[model samples]
Every structure is written in structure tokens, then in C-alpha cells.
Target: MRNMKVFFFFLLFFSLCVEFSRGQKEITEVNVGVVTDVGTSYSDVAMLCINMSLADFYSSRPQFQTRLVVNIGDSRNDVLGAAAAALELIKIKKVKAILGPWTSMQAHFLIEIGQKSQVPIVSYSATSPFLTSLRSPYFFRATYEDSSQVNAIKAIIKLFGWREVVPVYIDNTFGEGIMPRLTDALQEINVRIPYRSVIALNATDHVISMELLKMMTNPTRVFIVHMYSTLASRFFIKAKEIGLMKPGYV
Candidate 1:
């Protein structure tokens, strides 16, 4: 996915470069924007990879007379922040294209700005199916939508013969994005969903433990975990700490 992101971004800037190169004598610099949650570990890694990819892309293709200059923006992991970042980049930095807004909710707002500004919005990680409904030619998703995985999930549930299943997901747009498709898939397999567990993005260990404890009272044992990796890891740890990972529980 990261490689695809780099490829898409390069494709945008490269196209611009091609146009800029024609009727130019000296090397031209093209400005592009990368907006994401700046302080997080994954964001740091993504930024590093983007920098490395840009360097490698140019090093081997030294004949090209166009260079892409990156402008980074911190979205602060908020929807409005992402929109603001894109607007600032478009107005102030005059970036030709935008790389990210991270979450689907953030992308939701950023897409509108892109529509008004006529700048392309490309995302590598925002996988909401809702984005496609907008029918905006400016928006591009590097990754597949959450609904794309529902068929596999349905097949697995059918194979396991799990009569009852519960979806454990985040409360935000990322979590809700896949629910409709997954729900339909589970219904097709005759899997009854008694409850939907919603975890907050900033949920604490104690909160996760309480949620697990609440689930223990229910009859359902099968849980479809759909959430961010970091929060899911913490949730599983808390689950194991409370004996939720033992036999008879899925």
C-alpha cells in the first residue's frame, strides 16, 4: 500500500513535471503536500518512507529535469484539521496535489476542499466505501475499501459455522465504514449479531476491560475485530488479561 501511495503521488507529480519540462531549460521544482497525523509513530514511518522513495525515484532517473518538493502538514488527527491543512496547502504552499488526511472522517472533509480548490486528493490508508459515493473525480484511494473484505469475512464465518457473531469496531468513521457490507455478509451466512462493541480511539485499558466484562454476560462467543492495529493490540491484551482469549471464545 505504501508503494502504491508513492506510485500514485509520483504519477501526479510526474505528469506535472512532464508538462513543466516542455518549454523549460533548467530543472523545475514541483510542490506537493503530504498531510497526516504528525506526532504518531506510523506517521513518522510513512514520512520516512516517502522521503526515501522520492530520493530513490530521482537517483535512478537523473535525466528528468523536474524535482518534487514536499510540504508536510499536521492534521492533528481531526476532521476539521485535515480540511484546514489541505486549504492552507492549496492557498499558501500552492501544492499541486495532496497525499493524505489519514482517517476516513478527515478525508470526508478534505474531499470537499479538494472539490472546491480543484486539487486532487489521493489517500493511501483511508478505506471508507462512503468516499466513492461522492462521485468526485478529484478523490483517489490507493487502498481498497473496507467493504472489499466482507466476502472473505462471510466465507470464514460460514466455514466456522459460527451461528452468532459480534462486530467489535471503533466508534469513528473508520469503524462504521465497513458495517453495512459486513452486516449484509453476515446476514447471508445466517450469523446472528446480538451486539456491536464500539471502542473509542482514545479508550483506556480499564475501559476495554469493562467492555469485555460486559460481553462475557452475553451468549455470543464469536467476535469480528475491526479496528486500528494499535487499539486492537491493546484491546486483545486486556481481553487476555480477563480470560476472554480462552477456549470456547472466538
Candidate 2:
């Protein structure tokens, strides 16, 4: 009976020791959240869904050892959703950083929350010129800015010797932000904006077809500013269908 008791004691001690060792070796946990803007049905999930892709690209780097905690914000293309998601991540989840709310419209919500909470926000796809205007210290972007892209497009237009051009952009920050700059550049280049059209980011179908059809009449090179991927892809596909494919098509 005494021998059996000793064996039980030893077993308990061994289990405790194993548990303590595991506690010591536990990996550090890091929580990262993502909030996507609501545009198309897919917009709210696009950037958040792409986290694995981003992780794969950075897996070799040593800074990514901790597991990322991603949270989705369905900022239905509005500030409220972004703000709510950011608050949840910052206050509830205690995330170290955040990645998205992809559109500038959605980004504004995240940015506001991030500023108050002091959480770093890394935007992978937002290209709003207003973001640059804010010059917020915490705002960091991975995609090319609209100002630069607009300048390049202007140069391309000039280089191609295009006299007149048309503009087709989404109504949100991505589209609205580029319009003024593009217009200013056109004025500087001595070119005219013969036509202009705007579409909602959430528009699934070809809302700009009317403008496109009109532009096709004059055949002025079209400059399309699309921030949402679904819209961009669809626009390109439609442009091709309408026999409008060229080097500077959009």
C-alpha cells in the first residue's frame, strides 16, 4: 500500500513539472486586426481575407514570430463601421496593430480610432489623396498614392500625344481624390477633359457604361480611377468587351 501511494505522488509531481515547463516555453502571442471598407459585397472582406497572403510574403522575416489576430470591420463604406471595429480591436482585443479598412472612406474611421488609441494602422490598398493631405503620423500606406499615379498617368497621356481625355472614377476617396489632380494636370498639359463620369464603389454592374458609350463616340482616351478590386476588374473586363484595350486605357 505504501509503495502504491509513493507511485501516485511521483506521478503527480511529474505532471506538475511538465506543466510548469510548458508554461515557461509558451510562445508570445500578438494580436493584429483588419478592418475592411464596405464597397461591393466583397469589399468589407477583401483586405482582411488577404492577410494570409501578406503573412506568406513576410514569413521569412523575424518580426513576424507572433501569431496575428485579425478582426473584420464591416464598415459598410462608412465611418461608423470602421470606428466600431477599431475600438473593438484596440480596447477589447488589445491588438498591437491593424491592417485595413481598405478604401480611404473606410480608412478615415480606422484612422480616427487609431489616433485616439495610439494603435499603428497599416493601409495596404488605400490611395486617397486626402490621406496625404492629413499627414497623420500614424498613417502608413503600402500601396502607391494617387498623386504619384496621377502624375504618371498625365505624363503617359502627354507622351502618347493624346489631345483629349475622359475620366471615369469611383465616387469614394479613390475616385474623388484623383479627379481634381487629374483635371489640374490636364489643364497644365493643355489638354481638355472632354467627358467625366463617376460610379459608386458598391456598384456591381456597369454604371459607367453610359459615359463609356459616349466617350467611345469621340474615342478620347479614358482614364479610370478605381480603388476597389472588384470594380477595377469588372471595369477592365467591360472595357475589353467594348473593344477598349490599350496601354493607357485606365
Candidate 3:
């Protein structure tokens, strides 16, 4: 009886040690990989917080040991440059995942490389709906695509009880890709586009503004500006100057 009692005590102690070791192992191992676009600063709110949030997900979740390898590229929104940057990170650094190439143009090239290399690339603000179905198994996005935003715009129009909607979309992929969907959704809501304009990203002068103002004439009261940050700011400022938008709207 004495020998049996000692054996049972030893077994219990061994089990406790094994459990403790397993728990310790669980607490220490985690990694994640990130890639930020050159258009954004490392300390910039959009780039830093967005990438950190993904890394934080694995760190907080018990399922992963999230060790991260982040690489910032100097593409300045160039597609080929972004692709090359991604290739170097994946091939040399062996990053398991990437989260960037912040523009549709950049993502366009990177997606092909990512598909070929078997690495996953997740984008935050790429906004082009066309990219949604392109090599989709590897590409993921946290935000709604341009199409979804267009749907949202349609819903907003309905909520505001606006009859005529004039869409002022940029001529880029981000804008063109979504305009059709927005138009369809608005049509379903019995809304019509009395006016529309597709302007390039860089046309800052009143050439486009005069055209937009003519479209904004008494018929269409509400205007939806579908432009990137820089262009949006420029358009808003010019629109305000031309009395198209009120100070509050600005």
C-alpha cells in the first residue's frame, strides 16, 4: 500500500509538470508579417494602425503565435514597383503574409505575383471591385469594395429621399469600377443621374469644375464625389469656391 501511494503521487507530479510546460510553450510563440505602401508614412495613422491591427489579431487570439516580418516599400503607388517590393519580401524575407500595396494599381500587379508565389496579400483601402474576383483566393480586404460603397451611396440617397443623383467620379479604376454598380442600385431605388462627370486624378483647374457646375445646375441638388483623398480635398475646395458647396459642406 505504501509503495502504491508513492507511485500515484509521482504520476500526479509528472502530469502537473507536463501541463505547466505546455502552458509555457503556448504563451511564448507568435509571429505575423506586414508590408506597408510608400504613399503612406510608417507613423501615419492609416498605415501603422492598420498593419498593427492585423498583427494584434493573432497576438490576441490563442490560435496563433504571430511572429511578424514587416517591410515598407518605396513604390509611391507604382504597380511594378509594388510588385517588385512584394517579391523581394516574400522571396528573401520569407514573410508568411503581406498587408499593403494600398492602391488598386499597386494591388493589380502584386496580386499576380502573390498568386504565383503562393503568398497571401490583404489590402485595406484598395477599393476597386474588379480586384475582388482577381486571384481571389489569396487577396483579402478589410474594407468594402468600391461597388459596396456605391451601394451604400444609393442607400444614402434613398435615406435622404433624393430623386436625382449626380455622381462625380474620378476617371481611375477605383471610380469607373464602382460607377456602374452605383447607377444600377440607384435605378432600383427609382433614382436617376441627371448629371455625371468622369474626370482624371490630376485636373485641378476650373475646366472640370465648370463642367461639374453646369451639371449641378438647379436640377441636381445632391452631388456624390467619388475621389481619393487628395483629389477629394481639391474638388471640395474648388466646389466651395464656385459656390457649388456651402461652407458647412466644405
Candidate 4:
């Protein structure tokens, strides 16, 4: 009887262990790649948001068998750097999806890579119309194309009764891609573009100031400025310094 009791106890323990092991699910890991220039505030905020979202998703769904893992790579705000980061993520990390290269210029090459590798490339802030996702099914744009805003700008011009306007934009893929749409939109409303000022992405304060001075000499008070936030901030600072922000200026 003692032997039988001991054997029953051992069998029960073994059964419970096997049942517990069966109940615990194996974690399925899905690796996601984040490629961005961490030096910029935009990328920094993106990283924070991505982390928060991942944390919230996992915390709210404890029963989820699949876990998403994020691997971040800095593109260093250049084409070559972006390619390198993407290559590392695709080859070394074997990420399922890649998020960002920030600008359309950077996305141009990365999109091609993603297509070849059959990985999705997601961009939240790249707004250049030239980088069309239609060309590459793997490319996804989270933000609206820059051309979409041209109609709103045209409406504003019509409401204000501005006869002519000047567009001051960064001289890059982002800025150039919107020009044709903007011109067409403005022309439809009989708005004339007296001049289009192109500011280089790496232009210095002095260069921006000079450009503003040239614009001030012109009679057009209503100016449309389009660029990344970092360059836009500098432009406004110089505008304020030169009294271009005074009354009667738009």
C-alpha cells in the first residue's frame, strides 16, 4: 500500500508538470527595423513613440503569442548611411519590416532594397510625391503627399485675395516634387508665382538671410514656406531678425 501511494504521488506530479508545460505557449519573435537619423528631433520623437506603442500593445495583450522586437539603426541623414543601415537590418538582423529613412531622398534607395528583399519599408514623415508607393508595393507612406496640401494653400491664397505669391522651399526631393502641383493649383485660381526661392538643405544662416533680403526687395508680401521643421525654424528666426515678420507681411 505504501509503494502504491508513493507511485500515485509521483504520477500526479509528473502529469501536473506536463500540463503546465503544455499550457505555457512558446513566444514567436517578430523583428522590426527602425532606420532613421537619430540626430534629428523628428527621429527622436519617432523612437519614443515606437517604444511606447510596443510597450502598450504587449502590456494590454498578455495572451498574444507573438512578440514584436525593434532594432534601431541611424541613417546619419545621408543616402549611403541609409543603405548601410538597411543592409545591416535586412542581412544581419533579418527584420520583417523596416520603418523610415526620414526624407524621400533617403527612401529612394531603401525602397529599391526593400523590394528586392521582399520586406516592407514604412515612412511616416516622407511626403515627397516623387516617391510613389504605387511603383513599389512594399513601400508605405504614413503621411500625405506634399502635393495634397497645394489645394489648401491655393484656397488660402484665394481667400486672402493675394494676387501673387512666392514659394520658399528647401532645394531637395521634398521641395522640388511639390512645385509642379503647387504651380498648377495656383494657376487654376489665377495666382501668379513671381519667384520660387530654393534653399539648400545644408544652407547656413547667412545664406538664408541673404535669400530673405532678396525676397524683401520684391513686392510680394504673401510667401509660402515649405521645408523640414529644422530648416523652417532657422528661416523664421532670420525673418524676424530682418523685420520681415512685421505687420503687412504674410
Candidate with the greatest lDDT versus the true structure = 1
In candidate 3, residue 59 scores what lDDT? Answer: 55
Better of 1 and 2 by lDDT: 1
Give the lowest summed-lDDT range of ten residues in model 4.
1-10
Candidate 3 lDDT over residue span 56-162, tens digit each: 54455545332233466556456677777888878777665666667787887878888888877777667788787685687766566777566667777889788
Q: How accurate is candidate 4 locally (lDDT)?
A: 0.82
Q: Give the higher-lDDT candidate: 2 or 4.
A: 4
User: Which residue runs of candidate 1 sit more than 4 Å off their true CA positions?
Assistant: none
- TM-score of every model versus the real structure: 0.93, 0.67, 0.73, 0.86
The TM-score of candidate 1 is 0.93
lDDT of 4 at 152: 89
Sort by TM-score, best first: what order? 1, 4, 3, 2
Kindly report the root-mean-square deviation of model 4 from the true structure over all alpha carbons. 13.1
* Better by lDDT, candidate 4 or 1: 1
lDDT of each: 0.87, 0.66, 0.65, 0.82
Worst 10 residues of 2 by lDDT: 1-10
Task: Quantify how close model 3 is to the true structure by its C-alpha RMSD in Å.
Answer: 12.2
TM-score of 2: 0.67
Model 2: lDDT of residue 149: 78
lDDT of 3 at 92: 74
